[model samples]
Target: MTLGSRLTALPAVMMTPVAALMLATLVVLAPGLALACEDLTNRTQTAYKAGDLATLKDTFAAAEANADCSAETLQWMGKAIVSTVLRSVHEDVSQGGSLQAHETALREARPYGQDWRLEAWLGDIAFERGDFTEAATAFQDALNTLNDEELTPTAPDTAVIEEVYNKAEMARLAAADYVSAPTTRSGEPGGLAAPSYRGFQPAARLVPVEFQFGSTLVTPKGLRALRDLRDALRASGTQSITLVGHTDPVGGMAANDRLSLARAESVAASLRNEGYTGQIYVVGRGERDPLQWVAPLTQHQYHQALRRVEVRQ
Candidate 1:
C-alpha cells in the first residue's frame, strides 16, 4: 500500500494520529545510507514494510551490534535505528522498541563523532509533532554538525556526494524558515504592518490537516481539514485560494525553502486531484514566516504549533 493508504489502514492502537502522520513524512530521513549496507539494511526495511515491530526491534539490535564493522556503517546504523525507532514506538506492538533503544544506539555511536543525520532526524520529529522551535533548533545544530570536516566522507561516487550537498542545502533552507516561525511578530491592525499574519479567522483557528515531515503530503487529519477548508472557502466566496507552505527548521535551509514551496505545490496537487479548478495559487513561503510566535513552553507544544501551512482567502 502507498504511505497514505498504509497510514489510514493502521489501527489507532498501532499508531496515534500525531505519530502516524509525523513518521510517514520522514520515511527517507537517512536517504541512501541503506544502499551502502544492503544486507543489514534489508532486514530493517523488511521489518518496517511488514509492520512487524517485533522483528524490527530485534533486527535493529542485531544490526546495531554486527554493523559496527566500519566507520560509515556504525554511523549509519545508529542513524537508522534512531530514525526508525522514533516512528516504531508509535506503530504496532513495540515488542522491544523504545526511545531508550535510540539513546543506547546513540551513546554507542559517540565514538564515531556526531553526524548531521541524528540532529536532522530529531528536527524532523519535532517538526512532524508540530514543534517548530525545536525543529529549527535541531536543524541549526545539524548544519553545524555538517561544518565539521572530520565526519566520514561519502564514498567516491559523484552522484552520492551531490545528493548529500542537495539534502544539506534543503536542510539549511528549511532551518531558515523554521527559525522565522519563532521570531515573527505581527503588525497591529490600523498600524504599519498587515492586520494579522495569521490569516483569515475561523479557518486559521482550525488547521485540521497536518503534513508528514519533509513532504507536502497531508495526513488523514489533514485531508479532513482540507475538506472543511474547501467548504469554508466556498461559503466565504473565496474566488481563489493561496496555499502558503512552511517547514520546520530541519535539513538544509535552501532545500526546506523549496520544501515550503513544495508543500504549497503539494496542496495544490491535491486540489487538482480532487478536481479543484478555481484559481488555486500556491506560495512557498519557505519558513520565512510563522503563524505562531515562539516563547518558553513545552517542546511538544512548540513542535505542534509550528511546521504547518496556512490558507489565505
Candidate 2:
C-alpha cells in the first residue's frame, strides 16, 4: 500500500476499545464545555436584562477568555457588551453626569462593529446628557446602518434584534427632545439663587419613589407622597422647594442623571398639577449622594434607596 493509504487504514486497525475511549472523552468533555459556556451566556443575558452593566461587563470579559465559545457565542458576547454599554449610558444621562463618560463607554463597546442599535443607544445617551450635536451624529449613524435586509417580523424571528433597533430609535427621539426642550441647567447651581431666600431655613421633606428596571415612572406610593407634599407646601407658605434626585452607582453617570431627572420631573409635575405655585428647582445628583455611607452593598438595594426624589422646602 502507498504511504498515504497505510496512514488512512491505520484508524481501521485501531482497537474498538481505544476508539470508544476517544469518543467517550469527546462526549464527556464536549457537553461539559457547552454547559459551562451556556451558563456564562445565561449570566450575561440576565445581567443585560436587569440593566446590571457592571455584572454584564464582568461576564463578557470571562466569556471572551473561554476557549470553548463558538463563533455565535462570541457574537452574542459582543452584543451583550454593547448593550451593557448603552444601558450604562442611559443610566449616566438619567443621573445627570458628564456626557463624555457615556461617549467613552460607547467607544469601548465599539469593537462589536457597526451595530446600529448601539449607535442609536449612544445617540440617546448624548441627547439625554444634553449633547444634541453628538446625539444627532449617533442617530444618523444608526439610521445609515439600518436597512430592510436587517428587519425581521415576529417575536420568534428576531425579537432581540428588533428590540435593539427600537431602543436606537428611542435614543434618537431622546436626542431630539434635548434639542427642542427648554434649556435647563444641568444639576449645577445656576447663578446664585436670588437673595430673597438667602436667609430662609431650608425645610426638608422626604419623598419616596420606586423604579423598576428600565423604567422611570413613579409608583402609586410615590405619587401619593408627591400629592401630599404639594398640599403641604401650598398651605405652609414656603417660597420655593428643591427637588433633588439620586441613584445608586449601578449604571453609567449619564443614565443615572437621566433617571434622576425623570424622577424629579415626575414629582415636580405632580406638584404643579396639585397647585404648587412656589418656585421649583430640580437637581440630579446621580450616584454621588447615597443615603447610606456603607460600601459593598448590592446594586439592587442601593438602587432601591437611591432612586428617590427629595423635596427641600
Candidate 3:
C-alpha cells in the first residue's frame, strides 16, 4: 500500500478504558509525532526565510501526511506545501514530476483554505507556464496577504538562521558568477585558459597539487609537485606565482575561510623558503569552489582534501 494509505490505516483503537487512559498518558508524555507537525511548520518558515524551496517541499510533505494533524493544523500545513511546490515550479519549469507532486498536494490542501499560499502557488504555476508578469503579481499578492500577526513568534536558534542565510547568499553569488563568467572550454570560468608564462606552458602540466585534510603541511608528493612547478615557472621566465587554497564544505564558513587562507600561506612560506624569489599572490577559497558537488568523500576525507594549495604562474 502507498505510504499515505498505510499511515491512515493505523488503528486508533483502545482495548479498554484503562488502556485508553494509558494511550492518552503516552501521547502526553511523548508527543513527538504531534510535535513533528509543529517542527514541519517551523522548518517551512525557515525554508521560506532562506528561499530554499527543496527543504520547504520535504517539510510540507511530512506535515501533510501527519496522522496526528487536525483540521486547524492542516490549514497551515496545506498552505506551506502549496507555497513550496510553487517555488519549485518557479525554479524549474520542465520538472513535470515536481509539478504533478505539487498538484497532488494542492488537491489535498485545498479544503483547508486557499489563502495567500494558494495565490503564491498560482503565481508560481503561472511563472512556470512562462507568464512572468502574472507570477510577479501573484507573489506580490501572496506577500501582501501574509498574516504576520498570526505567525508563531518562536524563533529558531540564531546560529542556524545565520548559517542558512550565509549559504543562501553564497549560492546567490555563485549563480551570479556562473551567469557573468560562463565556464570556458578548459573548465575555468571564462573561455580563457591559464596564461602560459615563463618556462611553464599549459601543455606540460601535471596533476594539480592537492593537500592533506585540514592541515597546511604539504605532503612529500605535494612538495615534489611544487618543485617541478617551480622549475617550469623559472624556465618560462615567470616573475610571479599565485598560490590558491580550496576547501570542501565541512565546517562553518568563517572557519573554512581561515583554514583555506592558512593553507595558502603555508604553501607560500614553503616556496619562499625554497629560494624561489618570484612574487607570490596567496588566496583561499574555502569550500566555495568544490571539485565535486555532493562529495562522496567522508567528512574526514573532505576536510583533508580541502587543506590543499595550488600554484599558478
Q: What is the C-alpha RMSD of each candidate to the true structure, in Å?
A: 19.0, 23.8, 21.1
State the lDDT of candidate 3 residue by residue for 38-157, as single tens digits: 766676566655656567566655666788665555555444444444344333433223432454554444443433444444543444443443444444333333322242122223
Q: List the residue pairs that clash in candidate 3.
A: 198-236, 198-237, 198-238, 199-235, 199-236, 213-304, 247-287
Q: Candidate 2, TM-score vs. the true structure?
A: 0.33
lDDT (Cα, tens digit) per residue for candidate 2, span 184-289: 1232111111111122222443345555554567655455545555645654577788998877677899998888887787677777887778888998877777
Off by over 4 Å in 3: 1-207, 292-306
Candidate 1: segments with Cα more than 4 A from true spot: 1-208, 294-297
Pick the lDDT winner: 2
Give the Cα error of residue 202 in candidate 2, in Å.
Answer: 6.6
Looking at candidate 3, what is the lDDT of residue 262? Answer: 89
Model 2 segments beyond 4 Å from truth?
1-203, 293-301
Q: Judged by lDDT against the true structure, how good is candidate 2?
A: 0.51
CA error at residue 139 for candidate 3, angstroms = 51
